[model samples]
Target: MTGRGATTVWHEENIKRTFEWSAGAIFAIPLNVSCQHFNVSKDEPVRLLAGTNMPHLMNLFHNEDFIFRNPFRFHDRFSNDADYFRHNKRLTVRSWETNLIQDVNAFPLDDYPMKGKGVRIMRFGIAGTTYGCHIQEFPVGSRSTFHRHGPGAIVTVTQGTGFAMVWREGEERRRFEIRPGSIYSPGDLMYHGHFNTGHTTMRHFAMRGRSPKYSQDRYRTPLHDMIPFEEEPPEIHKEYLEELAENGITEAVSVVKE
Candidate 1:
């Protein structure tokens, strides 16, 4: 997610293409393609975070050589087009179906008031993969509604600082401190929410197994899974105020009323 680098991909018919990227750049490699990454800067090391379903694939195939050295070419998923990695301006609902996002930190987002106050989000469909990704931002002193979904979501904090409360039904909640570059994943069906304590808006990117367009029954999160602000326990808000106080933030940043 940091530094500058380039990826060279060898596609079908011996076609080769190179994509250059920097911090906040998001892209996906075509399935079964031969690709190599290079760090462009000598002084700064590159850190690329990738999410894949390789574990499931490995378990299903039970063969490393076939999985890694397969000759199968997903011709429909990739092409020799010169603008394959260019940013796509088209958006379906809040989703952007593209191969690359130049800088997610600077990308505009659409309002998602259902998630929380002053929250914005943009979902991404990358490289025709069933996997999904999205960028979400919530205002400071605010928190998202507690919700639960199936596992396989890897979240990376890209801006601001805060903490996440995670738990299961009828269990004690655990607080995990979060800051820029922090990565975490909530376990299967675990209830979780984020609280932004920093002065600026908190933003995070999540790559998961379910996509907005491609519905998967195994990973679907029903509407009833979300715990509304009014339904949450009073102690949740009480502890949030306590945390804000500990951080020396006394501003009257109105939180969602319980």
Candidate 2:
């Protein structure tokens, strides 16, 4: 999450490749690959946040030697190609078919008005993994529509400050304060929304349970699962305005109507 670093990845036949990264960089290691990380900066410490499906795999296999020491190579997922880690900008709809993102905080995103006013988003996959992620941004004083999905999404604030409200249906809403580097995950099927109270645009990265491209689940959330602004509880907007006022923000840009 901070400083600069390099990662050395080893593949079959002793093939080795290294890539450098800085803050906001995102990449995935190929499944079962041997890799090592180095902090390139001498005086600064490098901090990184990573999520994995290893727990699920371990539970299913329940064998350390089979899970960790297996020699099977996923050649289709990764190779020793020199450009394996290069940034790919190709977009299919809102999805970027890339193995790496150089800087997610600055990556251009497409308008996603369905989620909220002034909202933009870009989904991406890494190393053909089912655990992919997306980046979303919204202007200050704006908030996203309330929505819910399955569990296992790690939401990390990449820029600006904000707060999120999470709750189950018919339950009391719980608020969580967030800023750059903050991380939180909503429970399974829990409703959640994010409000931006900072001066600059708010951006966050959500590493999700399954990639949209490769998901096989039959019970994914439907479009109707989202709660429209007009249908939301009146107290939501009132609370958002109070937050903005507390931050000394007199004008509520892109604030949804109650």
Candidate 3:
């Protein structure tokens, strides 16, 4: 809501170096960050009840009742499982938002034209270690539904202020007065999300998983890309498209018709 359009603070300076910066000569910028919940899946009860009673339990986990994992939960070996990641069943990166289980950026804030004040993904790494560069802007009064990720992620506040919380069942587990420069994290299965907790608009960066530990195929599909970008992400903010194109990646994300 700064009339300054949007402000994006992502740097794709090769996912192989530290994102720390210097003022002019040499200065380590103290980046403020906090992790809320360290677990997003095992730490929470997923709706596994959807397929609990099938007599052929083996068949269920494979044919009828096996719960399909979202990109975040994709284990490295899934690619070998034909029933799930079979050659024909393999998943590719779909459009980030609408293509999958969640709504793509409903209120689009063009990361470019908006002065980067909107949502975005920042890529970073150092020598071989992992780091997060993804960022997001939550318009006032917005809220995401229940979901989980396989990555132990972090959320760093770069702009705006708001409230965020973690939960188990329908109860409010822990809450934070999300403010600019504050970081909160959701552990592996810490079933959680947030609203534009502040009366004004809210924005933050989500660090998706460890950097160097991520597998190569992880970036290829929404199933492994994590971050919940759906099957056919909407004709999104042009910045995202441009980023994919720059990475030598293509618009090959897939969709399964119901």
Among these predictions, the greatest lDDT belongs to 2
lDDT of 3 by residue, 1-258 (tens): 111111112122312112221111111111211111111333333211011122434565665323332223223322222222111211122112110111112223333111122233323221122332333555443333334565456676555565565654455556567776566767666655554434455655455654322444444443222224242224332333354355453531211111
Model 1 lDDT tens row, 1-258: 568999988875776889999998889998888899999987898889999999999899999999988998887887666778884755465677789888878888987677777778888878878888999987777778888889888999999999999999988989989999999999999998988888888899999756655654433444548898888898988888888788877762535542
Cα lDDT of all candidates, in order?
A: 0.82, 0.84, 0.35
What candidate 3 gets wrong by more than 4 Å, as runs, is 1-132, 169-174, 212-216, 223-258
Q: Model 2: per-residue lDDT, tens digit, 1-258?
A: 669999998876876999999989988998878999999987889888898999999999999999989998898888777888984855465677777788988989987777887888988877889886899998877889899988888999999988999999888999988999999999999999988999999999998866756763422445447898888898888888897999998767655442
**CA lDDT, candidate 1, residue 149:** 84
Lowest summed-lDDT stretch of 10 residues in model 3?
21-30
Candidate number that wins on TM-score, 1 or 3: 1
Prediction-by-prediction clash tally:
0, 1, 41
**C-alpha positional error of residue 10 in candidate 3 after TM-score superposition, expressed in Å:** 24
